[model samples]
Target: MANRIRASFRKSARSPRAGDGKHRKDVLDSLQELRNSIEKLDDTVQRFTFYNLQMAALRVGIDLSLFSSLVESEKPLAVGRMLRYLASFGAIKETEKDTFTSTNISSTFALLGFQAAICHYANTALQRAFNTTQPAFFWLQTQPEKLALFQEYLTTNCAGMSTFLDAYPVREHPTALHPERVFFVDAIAFRNRYRDLAGRVVVQDLAPTLQHAIQHAGVEMMEQDFFQLQGIKGAKFCYFRNIFHDWPDNKARIILQNTIEAMAEDSIILVDDMVLLNAGVHWQAAQLDILTMTMLAARERTQEQWDQLLQSAELKATSIQTYTASLEDSVIEAAPV
Candidate 1:
């Protein structure tokens, strides 16, 4: 009886081996799936890491102001030679070697007139992130570096207008009289502002030829707010660029009233700014309009807005011309009614 019981136990143990092969296959399948999942995760992480690194590199390059200097030079140069040039400009610290430390590179880029590309890219990125029509203006205001960069960028970019003006000849019309003197009005003088920040003045002593040209054309530089400007009794042409959008409808109206009080019927008001087009027209300009709305509670005007503003200001728009530079800005010619 004992021998028979032992034989039964041995047979039962051997029968379970038949199912062992199927169990092992199931385990192997799960292991393979896990391995494949892990490989996919690794790939995703690597791609994200690479994108972040590229953005960081761009930011570092821009904050160092290396790009602007390169653009200003209008030539290509080695990185080491560029570092030396930056040091000479007092934009960077002198190093024993020609190589610039990361710190120096970032500090130089933070300065005014050297951070356009950075701001442009950042703003565009921010707009994408929020999925909003405009770039967040509050972010720009809070970030002093971005604000400084934008102002500097505008200044540098706007200077190129000299070429555009030279290219287009101002027509002399008997009915459309040119001002005996054209005056530029702003609260802060460009020279004083530049000196205060940069420890140097630019265009303070206007170029001899430029001065002679202005004199010949009967133009003047007036450093005062248009609203507060005095001693103007004739039909002088008043020019404003990127100015009117800084205020709301009521405040802008007041400014226009001040101008009307100071000028004659024949006075021309030239507004150089962007006029927002329809939805499909220009996305960038439309985005800027929304951005202005958030920042200063202002906006880029539409044709209707422009017409309304001019009418409220007691001015009539006679002609409007658009220029396509890197960005589009318009020139509106108006006369006091």
Candidate 2:
């Protein structure tokens, strides 16, 4: 699959008209402009925005029930007949004079993935975030750290790691929508839930996010303050993603200590974050490192730093797995001494 994907990428890049990275730059340039405007990013910051408007449209279509309504309706869905506000977005256009229908794009976004009863769940979560994340949004209105600015977009505090647990959209019990999102705790557990062997997943998170998850299944809500953790003892595996990037070495050491304490003798703890490549590395990791600094007052780690961190808590790194060959995110797995 990886080879096929790489082949497809090579095929696309070998286009006769466009030279290497030309088409990519053109596509990213438009995106950078849009994000600059929407995020209110500084006019000086040259960053790409890429298809964000389409994502906004997709989010809207999911929220308004427009796609579902059009699917159920036998007739075309004209802009005028639909939400008065949506006429401007051009989500659906007039097929005949004033007559509109659900475009193929809209249909794919809604119907492609979800339970019939829970179709609107994501919409509801976004609505909740819209209300709760307003402060962070207002603060982020064109901050230098545009991406990490979203760190507080949902949670009020600068406490980065806790925000994911508190602000994650997929609450309401433990249904593994995406294994990547779940952060591989136990391969068996992930496999079981992925295959639907586990009836329903249960997750523990902060109050607000947990409340949302509780809608489907009442769950134990626990705020992330690793120093105070006593539960989860003797677990075979513990996983933390994008967590260490939020704190400095000292605080991160404390978090690792707690994780080590929670693990069983043979348990593994996976830290998923960007590890800096000192040599000929892609610009992506460097960009994220800057964002981390600007937003959280933290920085991404190097492989040496990661090893040092694990050793700080008397843990040993078993392996490091980088996604693709890009300087993107990676997983460092460690086991307690």
Candidate 3:
């Protein structure tokens, strides 16, 4: 079966390109079918052997400095048998009998392999391998390029999705009238979305993140640690977007408690996050859940779990306004009980 699949791939590689995207999709579908077959095998250990083999190859390649040496070499060095093995998988380009050149894929692997190695050696706790003791944000402070990439992701992440404003009645809320009391966390996207709305939006984060936000005008950027007490007291709205999921319930409770202390009787906390279903979760949400778990030992919550978390923090969810149905992304509106 594997031989047949390999033959199919060889045939497709030689085939003439079609005008439309159909040909490309057909190739992708065939590849996916092969992957699906591997995953569907009943022997779980054997199924995982494919991934183990790939990882072993990666480890061996790195240990021998195969990718870097090839990428930096002025002339192709004498290739090893391992080079031919990797070349078969398109990791490098085979030139002649025992020579190879680095491809774009191999070059990228060479560059990123350093970053991966750094992370791997720095920390290892369950699946959270980024750093020990410090949270993700703090750990990122040491990595400027990674921190920028993370901030960029947060800023443009809401491009096509239905924003919290579309689902939550922000305009009708009493807080809309008093913008001074609206405290927005991770203000990059939020400030742009609510620009026309009344209020001096105070964006809070660690000192490093606030530095980025400070360059932008209109919104007030404040250095804040959410784990500590929220600086501004009795705000009309204390909004957090995609923040809670980075923490487990214990750590999340501390953040909520701090926010609660700064809230007025009529104040609301808008938690913009995915409210996953109990069953048949969307693939995107499930992927994010796994990511959070790996990154911070956290998990995305179901509606019931959200309710329980809020209740533990002495807050009640007033409404769950789902703007994006496909990903179950919603603005969980809650207030002090």
Which digits, one per residue and each the tens of the lDDT, describe model 2 over residues 152-259? 442332222222232222224344333223332422324333454332223444444333332323222345556555356554346676778867788788888877
Score every model by TM-score. Answer: 0.43, 0.45, 0.61
Q: Residue 72 lDDT in model 2?
A: 76
lDDT of 3 at 245: 93
Best by lDDT: 3
- Predictions in order: lDDT: 0.50, 0.51, 0.71
Write the residue-wise lDDT of candidate 1 on 1-337 in tens digits: 5466457545644675535877556555655665465554333333343343233344545665564554455234346433433433234444354433334444546556545555555423455554655434435545566666666655554453532243222334332323333223321342232222221111111132123222211224433444454345544345566777766777777767776777765566667777654222233343345445544667677677899999987777887777753235777878876
RMSD of 3: 15.1
TM-score of 1: 0.43
Off by over 4 Å in 3: 1-133, 175-197
Give candidate 2 regions above 4 Å deviation. 1-202, 212-222
- Candidate 2 vs candidate 3: which has greater lDDT? 3
